[model samples]
Target: MIKPTERRVGYGVAMGYGVTDLFGGGAFAIIGTWLLFFYTTYCGLTVLEASSIFAIARVIDAILSPIMGYITDNFGNTWLGRKFGRRRFFLLLSSPLMFLYALLWLTDMNYWYYLGTYLSIELLSAMVLVPWETLAAEMTNRYEERSRLAGVRMIFSQLGGFLAVSVPGLIMQFTGKDNPFTYTLTGLIFSCVFCLAVFTTWRCTWEAKDVQPEHKFKAEVQRSSGLFNHLKYLILDLISSFRIRAFRLHIIIYIASFTAMDVFGAVFTYYVIYCLGKDAAAVSAWSSVGAFAAIPGTYAFMMLLNKLNLTPSSALRLAYSSIFFVLAFLFIVYYTKTPVPDMVFFGLFILNGVARAGLIYIPWNIYSFIPDIDEMVTQQRREGIFAGVMVLTRKSTVAIAILIIGMVLEEAGFVKGNGIQPESALYAIVTLMTLGTAVLLAISFYVTYPFKLTRETHKVLLKEIARRKLGGKAEDCDAPTRLVIKQLTGYEYDEVWGGEATRRVVGQVNCSRVE
Candidate 1:
C-alpha cells in the first residue's frame, strides 16, 4: 500500500508529467499539423519532397522504439532506488534535448535541412516519451485508479491539444501578420512550457523502492552462465509471452487501431487545407472547437465505460462505429454541396472532439490490461517490455502512415505552387480515407472480441496467481503443462502449487488427489 504522503507526491508527479506530455502534443500542432502546410505553401517544397521528409523521419523513429525500450529496462543507476533506476537519469538528460528538438520547427532551410531537423526532433522526443509512458504504468497497479489517472492525464493532454490548435490564430491576431515569425514564436513558447513541466516532474516525483537490490538477479545469473546465455534467456522470455492468447490478440488490436489513427493524423492537414480550401485560421477554429469539447467527451466516455460495464474492446467498438458514421456524414455534406452553415460545421467539429475522446482514452486503457494478463501468465512483472512493445507498435504505424500519405499526395498531382486541388477529388480522397480507416478500426476491434479479460476475469486471474504462488518457480513448469493448466483453469502452476507431499505420491494417487 502507498502511504498518504506518497500518494500526494504521485498526484503531483502526474500533473507534471501530464503537462510535459501535452507540451509534446502542442509542439506537434505547430510542427506536424501545420508544418506540412507551411512547407508546401510557405517554404516552396514540392508535395513529394515534403512527404518524403515526413516519411523518412517517422521510419527512423520507428526503428528506435524497441531499442530504447531495451535500454530503459536494463538501466541500473542507484542514485535514487531500484524502481527509479536509470529512467529518471535519462529523463533529466533528455528533457533539454526535447527543447532543442522543437527548435527544428523554427529553421528556415532547404528540403534536406528540414528532413534532418524533423528526424532529430522525433528521435529526441521518443527518448522522452518511451520512458515517460513506462513510468505511468509503474505508478500504480489498481484498475480503477489507473483509469482515474488516465482521465487526469487525458484532461491535461487535451488542454495541450487545445492550446496547440488555438495558439496560431492567437499569434496571428497579436502579431498582425500570418507568417513564419508567428510559427517561430509558437514553437519557442511551447518549448518553454515543455521544459518547465519536465523540470517540475523531475523535482517532485518519487519512485517506490524495489524490495530486491539492483542487479541481484543479474549477479545470480552471471555466476552460472556466460553473457550469450543471458541473451538467449531474454529472447526466450519474449517469445514465451506470445503463448498467452489474450496478450497476442491485444497486441494485434493495438497495432491496427493505432496505425489507422496515425494515418488519419498524417492526412488530416491536407484534407483541411487542400480539400476545404480553408486557411490556418479556419483549421485552428475547428481544432480548438474539437479540443475544448474533448474534455467533457472524455469524462462522458469514462461514465459510459462505467455505466455500460463495457470491456475496453466494447468501448472501442462503439467509438469506432460512431466515428465511421460521423465521417460518412461529413463526406456526404462536403461532396453533395449540402450548404452546411458555419454553425453546422462548428457542431460537427464539436462532435469530432467527442469522438476523439474515445480514440485517445480507449487504446491506452486497453494497453494497461495487457500487463495484468502478462503478470498472470509469465509470473514476472515486465511492464517495461509491455510499454516498449506498445511504443514500437505506435511508432511503426506512424512511419507507415507518413509514407502512405506522401505517396497519395504525390499521386494526386499535388504541387507546390498550386493553391489547392479540384473539389471533387479532394473531397473524395478525404472522405474515402476517413471512412476506410473507420472500417479497418471496426475489424480490429471485432478481432479482439474473443480475448475478453473483463474486470471479473482479471480478478479471477489475480486470485489464481496468488493462490498458486507461480512467481517463485515458474521456470519448472514445462510448456505442455503450462498450456494445459491455463486452458483448463485459466491459471498457470509451478512447483509451489504442489509441494513435497504431492510430488512423492504415485501417479494414480496424485491424479485422484488433484481431482
Candidate 2:
C-alpha cells in the first residue's frame, strides 16, 4: 500500500493516482480511433446518422455533469463514504463495469438501442470521472507535487493512446481492414486494459481521511434544511462560481482548445485513410509511434517545469506557440498533395508528439491550482464544482463538434466505405486536422493569455487562506496578503473586518498596490 503523507506523495502513490489515466487513455483512444469509422463504414450508417447519435448523447451528458459533480463532492462526506472513500468507492464500483465498455463497439443495434448503450456508458463515465478527477486535490496540496502527478498521468495516457492506435494497426496489418474482427478484437483488448487500470488505481491510491482545516466554513455552508433549500443553495453556489474572473477565462480557453483536440481525435482515422491514402498498418504506425514521442515529451515537460521555473500557464502558452508552427507546416504539406519522404512524415509526427505532452498535461496541472485560487477568493475550495464545469464544457462542445463534423463531412462529399475519397473531402479532412486546430488554438491562447494566476500569485493565495482560517488579523498579514488586500480594496486597512486590531491604518502612503 502507498503510505499516506500530508501534502507530499511518494512515486508509488503518485503512480497510483496517474495510472487511472490509462482508463481514459485506452477507452477514449479506442473510441476516438474507431467509433466514427465503425459507425459509418462498418455499420453502413450515414456520417450524419453516426455522428448525430454521439452528439445527442453528449448533450444529455452535459446536462448531467454538474449534478454528478455535486454528488461526488458531497457523497464522500456521508457515513458509508468516509469509510470506503467517496472517490475510491465510485472507482471500485466502476472498475468491473469498464469491461462492459467494449459492448459499445460490439453492437450496431437499432438507433434507439445504440443511443441507449452510448448514453449508459456516458453516465457511467460521469460517475467515475467526476470523482476520480477530484483525487489529486485530496492526495496532495503542493503545486509541484500536483504537476508531478499530471506528468506521470500523461506518460500512461500516451501509453493507452498508443494501444488504441498501434494495437489496431498491428492487428490490421495481419487481419486487414476488410475484416470486422479487427475492431472487435481491438475493443476487447483495450476495454480489458481500461478495466484493469481503473481497478489498479482504486486499489493502490490513497485518499485524504482528514478534511483540510480551512474548509470548515465551506462545509457548514453546504448544509440545507430541505431538498428545495439544498437545490437553491446549489443554484446560488453555481452562479457565484462563474463570477470569478480567472475561472471564466479558463472556461473560454479550455472549451475551445479541448473541443478542437477532441475533434482531431475523432477525425484522425479519416485523415490517415482518406487523406493520406495509407493502409491500416501505416495508419496505426504513425498514430502509435507518434504517441511514443509523448512519453519522452512528458519527461521533457517535467524537466522544464522544474528547470525553467516557468509557470504552468506560461509554459502552456509557449509550448502551444510551437505547436501552431508545426500544424501550419503539416497543413501546407497536406494541402499541396505532395508525397513527402517517409523520414519527414515520421519527424513531423514526432514533433507533434512532443507538443502533445504540453497540450495534454498542462491544462490538468493548471486545474489543480484553480482550487487554490478559489480558496483565496471564496475561502472555500470547491474542486467538485470546478471539475464538474470542466467536464460539462467538454461534453457540451463534444456535442457541437460531432454535429459540425457530421455536417461538414456531408458537405465535403465523403462517401462511406469508398476506398478513394474525393479531393474535396480529403482537403476538408486535412484542414480539420491542421488548420482547424491552428485557428481554434489561437482563440484558446487569447483567452489563456490574460490568466492572472501564477506560482507567485498562488503561493500568496495559499498563505492568505491559511491565515484567514486561523483567524489572523490583517495587521499580522504578510506582504503577499497586503498586496492582495490592496488589489481587492483601494486601501489596506490596519485591521481585518471582524478581528481585534483597533489601529485601522488608512494608509497615507500605500506600498502594497499590486504592480
Global lDDT for candidate 1? 0.63
By TM-score, the best candidate is 2
Instruction: Report the C-alpha lDDT of model 2 over 51-93, residue by residue, as the tens digit.
Output: 9888998888877877777776677769878888866888888
lDDT top scorer: 2
For each candidate, C-alpha RMSD in Å? 6.5, 5.8
lDDT of 1 at 150: 68
CA shift of 264, model 1, Å: 2.4
Model 1 ranges off by over 4 Å = 1-13, 77-84, 213-243, 306-308, 422-428, 470-515
lDDT at residue 35 of model 1 (Cα atoms): 77
Which stretches of candidate 2 lie above 4 Å from their native place?
1-7, 212-223, 475-515
Candidate 1 has a TM-score of: 0.83
